[model samples]
Target: MASAIPLTRADMKRLADYAKREGVKAEVQIDDFIFRVSADHPPAKVDGSEESELDRELMEFDRKHGYR
Candidate 1:
């Protein structure tokens, strides 16, 4: 049985910030009803064009990772 753990607002906010800063890519189960956070995965080449700025940023990220 899975029991939900109550999280405080501060805990949730901190978790969100950590996810953003680390660019967390995925979560996978480690045990029954439990999961572990995975490292940031390699980004896929973006499709379509909308924001020039975002495109530029993605390019930069890829360049830094030698994915370009």
Candidate 2:
């Protein structure tokens, strides 16, 4: 039995376009899409300022408690 795709036309179009561009079939790829959406992916970088703060925090943490 064929399953119904719950995605909207625009979403399917975007998926189809992306799949075509990447040379992949857009056939029932909802699982992969859902997995990617559900995963705990990292946040995107906006500015370079966060890098320095992160580095400083990491160094302070290491100094406070020795690195394993």
Model 2: colliding residue pairs: none
Q: Could you list the CA RMSD of all candidates, in the order they appear?
A: 12.8, 9.7
Best by TM-score: 1
Each model's number of backbone clashes? 0, 0
Per-residue lDDT for 3-60 in model 2, tens only? 5666877876776677656655545545534311222335776776888889889999
User: Which residue ranges in model 1 land beyond 4 Å of their true spot?
Assistant: 1-5, 25-68
Instruction: Tell me the deviation in Å of residue 5 in model 1.
Output: 6.7
Error of 2 at 31 (Å): 22
TM-score of each: 0.32, 0.31
Write candidate 1's Cα lDDT for 1-68 as tens digits. Answer: 65765555676566666766788843434345433344565778765675777989999999999997
Where does model 2 exceed 4 Å of error?
A: 1-45
